[model samples]
Every structure is written in C-alpha cells, then in structure tokens.
Target: MGGVDVVYNPYDRAVNDDPYPVYARMRTEAPLYHNADLGFWALSRHADVSAALTDSALLSSDHGPLLDPGASGPHARTFLSFVAMDPPEHTRMRAAISRAFTPRRVAALEPMIRQIARDHIEPAVERGTFDFARDIAAKVPLDVISELMGVPPAERAGVRRRSDALLRYDPAGQMSDEGVKGILSLGDYYRSIVVERRAAPRDDLVSALVADGELTEDDLVAFLFLLIGAGAETTTHLLCGAWYWAWRNPVQRAAAFGGAIGAWVEESLRYDTPAAGVARRLTRDTEWYGTTVPKDARVWILIASANRDETVFPDPDVYDLGRDTGKAISFGAGRHYCLGGPLARLEGRVVLEELTACVAPDYDIDRSLIRRTVHGNVRGMVSLPTTVKPA
Candidate 1:
C-alpha cells in the first residue's frame, strides 16, 4: 500500500465494495487520517478508534451521526435519538429505552422471531428463487420492530419507504430533495402513530415512550424516528450482511451449519461491520498518533478499519469463523453502544439457524444480482438474490 494516493471518499462506490485494502493503508499511512475534502478526521487503528469511541469526555455526538460535523446541528433537533445525545441527556434517555429492551424481553421474542423466520423463509424456498434482502432479510426486523413499536404490519412498507428517504446523510453528498422529503415524511408518519398510541395507550415501544412522560410531543415523534431508523434498518442490514458474507465463504457457512453459528455471527459483525464507523466531534484539541487534531473537528471513528487492525487481529483480512471477535465493536461500545445489539444478534442467530437447517444446507447467492448500498455511513446490501431448495 504505497501511501494511499487515492483520496478516501466514503461515498465512492468502488471503495465501499471492499474497504479493507483502503483501510489497511489508512491504518498504516495515516492512523489519524484527515480528509480535507470532506472536512473530517478518521482514526483507523483499533486502539485509536476504540479510545475515541469510549472517550465521551472528548468526543461528542450531540449534532448527528453523519461524518460531516456541519451536516446537522443541535438546531435541527427533530431526530436526535440517544445516538445523537451526550452525557446526562444520553444517560437518561438510554436508560429509559434500555428498560423497554430488557434481556428477558428480547429473549421472549425468540418464538415470534423463529415464527417470522419460517413465515418469510419457507415462502422464499417455495418460490425457489428470490431476493434474500427484500423477501427475508429486511422483513423479520421490520415486522418485529414495527410490531414492537406499535406500527401495524399494514403500515410497515410506508414506514420503510419514508425511512429510506433519510439516505441524505452527508453535506458532501448532494442532499436530494427526495431525501429531505423522506425524513419529513417519516416524522409526520410517526407523529400520527404517536398521537394514536397516546390516545389508545397500547403495550408497545411507542406507547412506552409516550407513557414515559419524559418526552414532549416533538421529542416523542423524534424518538419514534430514532427507533425505526436505528432499530429496524440496522438489523436488516446486519442480517443481509451475515447472509451475504456467509455465502461468500463456504467453509464458514459450513461451520455455521456445523454448530458454530455464534462464531460466524461475531466474525461477520467484525469482518463486515455494518455502519463502518460512527461520527463524533472533538471537544478540545487532542494529540493522537503524533498529530494535534484541532478542537471541534469532525471525526469518523473507523470501526471497520479497527475491526481489521493487523495489530489486534492476526490475518485480519481472512474471514475465519474460529477467530475470536470478543473485542469487536461492531455494535459500538461504551455510552453509545447500540441498545439494539442483543436484539440484532437474536435476529441474526435465529435466521441463520433456520436457513441452514430448514431452508437448505447451502445455497449459492446470485453474485450478479446482489446490489450493495453506496451510502457513506452504512455498510449494507440493498439486495441479495438467491435460489433455495427444500431440506
């Protein structure tokens, strides 16, 4: 890697397909890499990224989760979920949200999730060929989370379409009018549901938020936006990625079918980390990797790069299911660690188990039809086509 001559653009389609080679150069040539074009810094090493993730005192998340610091400020407080909060504010909201996702609560969903897996997969198998992402990967979490959030199954497609409009994450990327409208549409959609849930008071996440009494009407809708955006979408990508990666590595897929699904899931999380890294703002000038990053600079904590750091993971590029990924921060860590991790893992494990056992021992993914997401902030496949056969 002769000193990464290519300017690292997260939105670049070619780079997104396989970010590891570029990430290797970043970790070696510029651990505290700065992209002046995008006006942000990046920490590529596992040590550096992990430090920044846990350094809540220095790195801030109050603005938004996009890499560009100027993308959205506190003034645009319409969708600041706990992911975009700091300190006592984050603590209060996260604690409240955590209560709604207790381990017991998530575990109880196993039966429902298994049923959902069968409901989606069995049909896809019957069809013999289907786009895995649309038919199954995206459905389980959407159904579970939508139902959990009190949005009826009938409304899920509309919610998904609206939530997708929020792909306008960076100012560097031309913020299309469609994306802006999509964000607004989700806000309006959730606002209606919030009002309904408040009036009727059901035992769902939305009702729980409304009942918490800690959020104003505006905050209530914003929280709903956060729930759908963070919970459903991320888990969908995680499931999609797990399937895609498994297909790419037959040995690993076999191991997953051989009672090593947990290892496979963790390695997939580490190797093909969804959400390459998260955004943060520096509170004060900080010296890192022998350079002084200025105060108030935007930084993309490169968790994707860190997950493959040669220092921490030997032969980091290889997708070895036996590799210990206990230290991986794919779901993040510390204060902002994804509250949805356990639920996401539950979803991933259940789906993989069902696929390998009931759907087919192994099925080849249609590499030509698998379309990947080019979004700068998220690592996800939009489509993964595959043909399946009965067990």
Candidate 2:
C-alpha cells in the first residue's frame, strides 16, 4: 500500500475470489481510485462511498447499477426497471412497489421463509452431506421470492435455473449468449403471469401490480426480473458467504450457532456482501480529493470496500459477530436503497436459525468441492459441500 498503484477490474476472476486485499490497498492509497482501461472510477473509503450513494442528484442510477457494458445508457430501464430510473419516476415506481415490502408484510413472511428454509435443510440433514450453497442457500431464497411473486410450485425449478443463467457473465464482463436467452425467457414468462393476473387477480405481488395499473406490462416484467432475480441471487450469495466465513472462523461459528443469529447475519452482510458495489453515472462534474470528475462518467461506490474501511471498522478484516455493524452499507443508502433489505435480512436470519437448529453446530465444509462464481457486480460461492450431523 505504498503508492496509488492499485489496479482493480471487477471482471477479473482472480480479484473477485479475494478482493478484500485489493480493496484495502485502495482505501489506504487511493480512496478515489480510477481505472482508465476499464473506464470507471471507484470510491473505496466509507465516507466517500456513503456520500456518493446518498448524493443521487450528483451520482445518478439512470444508466443502471451494474458494470455490464450492454446494459447501459438510456435503455437500461428495460432490464433494471425502477432500479435504473431517477428522481420522480424512480420515486413513483419505488413507492408503488414498496407497499408490498413494508415492515409488516416482511415480518409476516418470516413463517413462510422459515418453513421454506427448513424444507430445504431437512433434506440436507437427511443426506448428511449436501452442497449448502446450491442445495439450500440457492433454493430457499428463490422459493421465497417465487412464492411472493405467485410463481407456482410446479414451475419454480425452471424459474430458478433460468434466473441463475441470467447472472452468468463471460470473460468480457457482458452477459453470455445463454444469459441473454435466460433473461428473454424470464421476460416472456413474467409477461404471461401479468396476463393471467389481469384475467383473474390473486393475493400476490404480480396480481397487485396488475391491479395498481401503475406500470406497463413491460415495466412489470422488468421489475419482476429485478425483484425476483436480484433479491434471490443476492441472498443466495449472502447465505453461502456466511457459511464459508463461519467455517473459516470457528470461534465465530460457535457464536453463530449459539443464538447470535442476528449479529451473525449483520456481520456477514458487511463481511461478504453479495453485490459488491453499484455503479452510478455522474450527472455533472464533481470535485473530489483535488480532482474534478467529468460528467457522464461511471463511478462505482464500493460497498464491500466501504464496509471494510479501516477508518470505519477497526480490524476490518476480522469476521467478528460482536462487532457493531450499524454503519454497514451492504444494503446501500438514500432513495435507491434496496427495496428488499428487510426481506433479505429476514431470509438470512431465518435460514441460519433453521440450519443451526436442524444441523449440528460443528458441521464442516469440504473446501475442495466448493465452487465460486465471479460476476462483474456480485461475488459468492456456487457450491459449498457441507457435512452435517443432525441436531
């Protein structure tokens, strides 16, 4: 961390594997880091990243919050839905959808979420050996979100498969051909749901959106994609990360298994955030650290890096469950903060609670069989082979 020679490219697979070291160097040497080759700037420090996240007027999300080259510019809303919108439009769409995600609604979902988590983990407990990431972590959140969106049990397997496909990225950091196909398929599928809801409304999000008549069919489809896809995918990674990190730290693992579920979930969110950071488009010239960033440039607010900022959390590398994670920016800030934050947290807590209650506290993971996924924005395990003793 001598000079500001840090080079960070989100598309790089090696970096995504263990980016904390690189993030540490960035926070120390180059808080306002820029990668000319990648054509993006990054803010690694907590204060800077927090400020940029809340400063929506200066740093906009109209171009989407991802680094995917194809999903940029004016048409980003086609894929990102309200997440890519700004100001009044975003406010309107967010407000409309938020009614379904209120604290009471999210709280009511706890029982369903817990039952779903148990359903997934019970089989793993019987098997004694299961890929925690794929078999449990992935399925719980997908089924939860699908249930919320009115996706039938018969169709959920296909939905989860295609949703996963949509997150696959090629070496060039763009969605692969399969990824494109997956998204198109999901769009068609969700559009059909919209039509059915229009015909016979139900007590579900899709039906509610149709009844509200606030969004076009296209908008409804995109919002469903963003909500179901991002919501499930991010929580999947978060669960896997918690499992991996807990295994790495046996002391904290004991605490997690010992009724510190809330603290464990909060720390995991800060430690290994699924969506590393989001990209924002600069609306106008901005000055920072004696330099002026030109308008229209892409600036990435490194939430993962900010969560680990030494200035904010001392001994930031340690995965301690007792640490005060009140300042973590894992779910983001400002008007565009994650609409599913409470849901994600609830899912995480309920899953871990079920895991510990169903499986033995000393369950172990097979490091050799673990598989990791590397996307431009999100990073986590694809498979975590764990062996558990039935509680």
Q: By TM-score, how accurate is candidate 2? A: 0.96
lDDT of each: 0.81, 0.87
Give the alpha carbon lDDT tens digit for every residue of 151-174 in model 1.
777888888887875644654545
Over the stretch 99-184, how does candidate 2's per-residue lDDT look in tens digits? Answer: 77789888989889988998888888999988898899989999998998999999999887787655775534566677778878
**Candidate 2 wrong stretches, greater than 4 Å:** 1-3, 171-176
TM-score per prediction, in order, is 0.94, 0.96
**Runs of candidate 1 exceeding 4 Å displacement:** 1-6, 68-70, 168-173
The lDDT, on a scale of 0 to 1, for candidate 1 is: 0.81
